[model samples]
Target: MKRILILFVLAGSMLSACNKFLETKPEDFVTPDNYYNTEADLDRALNGVYNRLVDNFGRMYSRGLFSFLSISDEFFYKNITITNLKVMDFDAGQLDVGKLWEVAYQGIDRANILLENVDKPKMDETRRKAIKGEALFLRAYFYFVLVDNFGGVPLKLKSTNNPLEKYLPRASVADVYASIVNDMKGADTLVSDISSYNYNERVTKTAVEAVLARVYLTMAGEPLKDVARYNDALIYADKVINSGKHNLNPDYSRIFINHSENKYDLQECIWEIGMYGNQLGNTQLAGAVGIENGVECTDDKIGYSTGPLKITARMFNLYAATDLRRDWAIAPYKYVTNTTTGVTTKTPYTAVQIYDRTVGKWRREYETVTPKNRNYNSTNFPVIRYSDVLLMKAEAETQVSGAPTAAAYDAVNKVRRRGYGKPINTPDATVDAPAGLDKADFLTYLQDERARELAFEGLRKHDLIRWGLYLSKMQSLAVDISTNAPSGFRYGANAAKNITARNLVFPIPNTEITVNHLVTQNPNW
Candidate 1:
């Protein structure tokens, strides 16, 4: 399916995607001043903007935010040899610290460039508007990623080709968030509805709304305790929920399977980084999602995985025995490949072995692509899902009302029922959280529920930070791991032990600090 869309991105030039119909020829020698002269040129430029969101190859998402840089209470990127980024042990000068910053700003810069040149093309007015909306939304999305990870960053609005463009000081966190909210809101008005598309990758109005809900919810929580944004989050979430175009995929494992197989579950996965090829193709566009986070496998034929990132008992114990998502979401067996036969084998683990399981939510065994690379797979990484929107809606409504309302419970219970492998519309009191919990208890429910339903989707650390539980939770995890972990796995506790208040926000890259004299390094970095 991915092969059908041969997208090629070379710096700021050459790229394409199949509407399942046509392809654009790669272009060159056309400088920015004269490039945006045709409709195809606009399309190519837009794809380049999209190309910046690779979410793999140590760039962002799975490799950066989700795995190495972001510290999680659910799992730790276990490596005794290189503990830098994984354990929150690195500083401003770390190569990955710069890479993460570069990747995010690259996307932002590309989006800015596309927007500036968008109007230059002589194209269909409606198509032009849609492209403009997507550029605006992606730009905001990039900024949101920046603000979420690094707090206030140097907010550069205009595109610059000049290497000597004056380095600006960091923007206030509040101002950066304001800009994100405004841009996304504007994009919501101009973008096409998801219902209009046969494909899953394009920036849709609901995607904007969903991200807006996330931004608002984040604003309402720790660091920025703007409680008023809870109402805004609820409103945007309602817009997406009321759209009637999205829902939880009945099978949770199948949702990820769809990503692995290059199939789109638009009903559940609201937005994703639609990657293609196994990095062996001419385009070389691929992601290291399943390979980095999947169940450990020794044989390449069985889907090779160097799974340094691992889940633990904390995640395994979150689910009840009846919750079908538990075993499927966490690999419950040991993987072995007989060298002579070259056949992979699975042996069921005893109960205690759950503590050492690799991340199973993105098993590479399901990847349909042939001749798969051991390091990179063309698996699409989800950015937002309908289930996440539902959770945000439930959380927002509860925050605004100062208690868990019936609507809040219903939103979450729907997800819970699905997790229990029951009909979502049917209410099972045995499975549902009771309706009368206080705000504190309900938030506690949310914390656990989110992990159960959405673990390894690259959100846990941010969720912990927003809830103001990051420092205390990691510190607690350190103590727990130290006391309870199996002897072989106890070293995993070191990552949590390395946590400090400063780890809540990643350091601004040393490259930026040195190049931009006006900017200051983050605290204790």
Candidate 2:
């Protein structure tokens, strides 16, 4: 399934590159009346929707979203945009903010177009339904991204037929979430079973359920504080776990490395956004997160990579030496070139230096096929993994019980055990297992474990925001970094003062406000 999807994307790209036939038609020239005629047309249109997953409007290969994760304590980047985010020194005019908004709406419009024309083709009922389900899921996912970042945004459920239909007022946050839930519920029945598919690249029943769990979990947290939703969160997460369709991959590193090879663990990855080829067509995750200006050795089959993304010293120190994920998740050294000998050697970095360490999760050296350009490697981004489901289940259980239940401990311990390379079924007190705790302590533990298990996967900021700890935590982290960081590495001076309640959600883009009078800026923007 993933290969087929990649081929479709590549074929579409080839067509556009070879000729101008696939290029955009003049406005007022192309219309739904002329476009929606066959199954092949629908497939081509649907591909446009999926293309947003890797589009460079906000930096391709999930870099736009991952940029938010970089602002959290776990990671850092030297780019001016990233620096602005780290210090909370950004507003409505931020380019990426506007780009993300534009790209998401573009995807939503594409999805709406597909939904409007899905039934025009005389195709198999199951196939048609699956296509419609995918469109709904994609739209909901795009809106979810928007709502999480920009608070309330204009909702466009149907395709726009004319210029008059383009302008839309912002929908209430509650209304937007309601639509998201409705779409996911509809998709749950329309999408096919995971086992029926060869890969988890596309939507499935379990994928819908997993995303519902995430949605419900988010609803149960900040800005809403609807604690009752925690039950729904637990119910949905448990459904995914008990479905027996997925489980945690024992080798955590393999989960990521497999992405570079175009291989997937359907048993672990619920849904992965597929990326293929090299250069502009490939994923930028490795180049954005891997070692900066490092070298490779032909004899050792090592490949080189360079990027601005780096791990924070605070994040690196969070891992216990016994945890296997530490070495696999954070690189402690970079390869240095011997100018005279033309040889490269590994050099350990100073522990407390900011931006001195690199991320290890997307290692370009482990790519199964060497990349034509080291800066662009085809590494699929994992959208949701089974391990996350377990942790979320644990979180919901604790929140619902107001204390850690036996099941809650089991869920969290499973991930912790895997981190230490211990057997999932056994409790290894010395190396893997931490002692059980009460509700408050367990929730705190779950937060840290999430950072440990899922750091740099683009969930950190959302997790902090939902926990209502975003401001306080960022403020505290600033003090710690400023106090402990080596003089030259101290970069958290503005963190304490700049981050505030108004930053809970980003300002609506100034471009959006300028073009659409119905759109209002977020508070304090």
Q: Candidate 1, after superposition: displacement of residue 316 in Å?
A: 1.3
Model 1: lDDT to the true structure: 0.81
CA lDDT of each candidate?
0.81, 0.72
Q: Could you say which candidate leads in lDDT?
A: 1
lDDT of 2: 0.72
Off by over 4 Å in 1: 1-25, 81-83
Candidate 1 residue lDDT tens string, 324-438: 8898778776578888897779867787786678777877888888797888877888889999999999999999999999999999999999998889988899899877899
Q: Residue pairs in steric clash, candidate 2?
A: none
lDDT of 2 by residue, 1-525 (tens): 133232122221211111011223212234567765777667666766776766643343446566542367776554333347556787778887777787788778878878988889788888888888988988998899889888888988987666666688999887888899899989888988899888787789899999999999998998777789899999999999999999888888788778756687999999987655444432222323232312222222455665455566767777887788987787766667777897877777664443566677776666655534544445677889999999999999988988889899889888988888878878767654356677888888889899999978878889999999988877887787678766655654454456778888888988989989998888888
